[model samples]
Target: MSTDSTSLKLKKEIEEAADFLPLLGTDYIELYVGNAKQSALYYQAAWGFQPLAFSGLETGNKQSASYVLVQDKIRLVLTSPLKEGGPINRHIDKHGDGVKVVALWVDDARKSYQETVKRGARSYMEPKSIEDENGEVVLSGIHTYGETVHVFVERKNYHGAFMPGFKPWNPAYQPEGTGLKYIDHMVGNVGWNEMGKWCEFYAHVMGFAQLVSFDDKDISTDYTALMSKVMSNGNGRIKFPINEPAEGKKKSQIEEYIEFYNGAGVQHVALATDNIIETVKKLQQRGVEFLKVPSTYYDTVLDRVGQIDEDLEPLKELGILIDRDDEGYLLQLFTKPVLDRPTMFFEIIQRKGAKSFGKGNFKALFEAIEREQKLRGTL
Candidate 1:
């Protein structure tokens, strides 16, 4: 791939993206961390998530313990190793408390597995049935770009708070929701040359279509460069951006993540909000740090993006970024690294009518990231 080329690889874009697996929305995101207890508490206190459920030795199930946190329709399952040499611990050592499963809510887990496997997705697991007094739910799995896996969850027949075995988690203190609605999208950082290979896999196996593509020309800055292509399933509910580093004058953010994370993994999770101003304000008050762009960025951004409904003052006050496409505009802000490794973070996005990622903000975003990398001595 030429770093200077602005042309799209037409062959790689799915002409008529398939719909073999009808997905509803994100069922939940499961992370393999070193400590689930503390992580759960951090989420509830910092992000305003509520304790929803728990699963562990109390149920005599597996060697790991998992705490499920909830806010609105969003669910996060944090799993930790109970002993030294277990699968969860291995993941923690390798990826350092990162996302493992991006589970999708589906209509049929059995058919979801069969159709995807037949279409060339690497089979992570066949459909399995799990039942409790509440009801029965089926699950299936398949591998995506790297070690990350996608689990198909069929819960039409289940009525428990979460999956079976996870009792209600009634912690002594529960925090209120922070106005976060659900997952807007998930972005992944891949190896230097593997972005298109997995994009094609999603087009075929997972029945996704190319929503948009940003070559080096669209996002390249003088010191940094990378290419991104967004993929979305039918109904436009799920979106994934696959990113790979491109040749540049300095180290790209995607390269830095792959280095410290030990391999390709989820770079960040974008959370949707109806009001980003209030949500980010509360988050900052609760100790969430965000990336700071130059004061000049807000000066001329309005000229480029045209007038928006949001007052320019608060957007600047909150360090929020703005972008516009043919459809409409969106307001987004980035949080600093959620863990010590600088691997995973969060994106707070509020879309008015825009159906695209913030292409216009890429240069500033990369520059902000580069500043952080220099401080860490990684650039």
Candidate 2:
């Protein structure tokens, strides 16, 4: 297995673009960090994600660290550079640790790469074929905002559960998964006047259609501001919201991420689960701390939102919150920043046939975050 840059070959754009629609779901999310072992353990224990595969010192990966973790349908690979002065280390030092790869499962890798490239995408990784007895798998990558990337995965020919050389991690340990079945959404934070550039990239290069748009007025506090536009595939299985900080009294969260990360990058990943109450219960028991809203917010929740399916008792019991709009309703809770810096968080979300993002919950969620900021002295 040659891991040389020369082995990477960029595919030319196809004359007729590949039908890049109807994304099945997220294949895997890769995060570049400072420590993959500890981060893998945290996901396995706290997030109820089990170890699916791993690669490191024993596997002849002498220059880096990596681990693949799974929870039901969701798969995440954490990778950190072993030595300093590399691209991965620079990403961690600047971004304070965040997602680096959003791998999308496709039928054809070369065609997918060609289709997106023809639409004017800047290439990150050229289409490369990795194979073993299980068969061959082709992969390609394109640049997105910040240091983030979208990897196109063509696995129809590969029969292996994951990539080659990874043993099925079956430990005596099994924690109740946090109802997160698949990735519901992944948000990106871009720099000022950069949202449109990235949005246009997705729209033209990847054939993504705009799902929704929100301005600083849509999601803001008196002290901070942000503008967002959500892009999704035709079938809507994949959703990405691009955000840029707007002028505010103080530095906005988007601004903070861009400043510390030294550029644009992913902000948070919202994982989907069928049963949020059970998921939250298990996560809480395992040391995953979520942001908490004041009790008073719940007092007027029912009156403002009217009737819903779930009983209010269970929601309050698990500290889960609900918000509704004319379109539909969504249940979401945010994890406190997990990394050392005040950046990179997770959103445990369950959508009950809702298509819209949880806009109604912004006020309560921001206030909870503000409370944390106050304690950290960042506010």
Query: Highest lDDT among the candidates is held by which one?
Result: 1
lDDT of 1 by residue, 136-235 (tens): 8889999987689999988888888788888888979898778999999999999988999989888888889989899999888888899999998876
Q: Which pairs of residues collide in model 2?
A: 94-261, 146-264, 179-273
Error of 2 at 372 (Å): 1.7
lDDT by residue for model 2 (1-379), tens: 1122322232312223222632455789999988888888888888878777777777677788788888877899999888878888877777767888999877666887888888787899899998778777788888887678889887767777677655456666766666678888899888899999988887778877787899878788878778999987765667899998888887777777676677887789998888888888888888888998887777988897788888888788766878777667778888988887777889988887677788877777776777787787766
Could you tell me how far off, in angstroms, the CA of residue 252 lies in candidate 1 after the best superposition?
0.8
What are the lDDT scores of the predictions, listed in order? 0.88, 0.79
Model 1 spans > 4 angstroms off: 1-15
**RMSD of each candidate relative to the true structure:** 6.9, 5.7
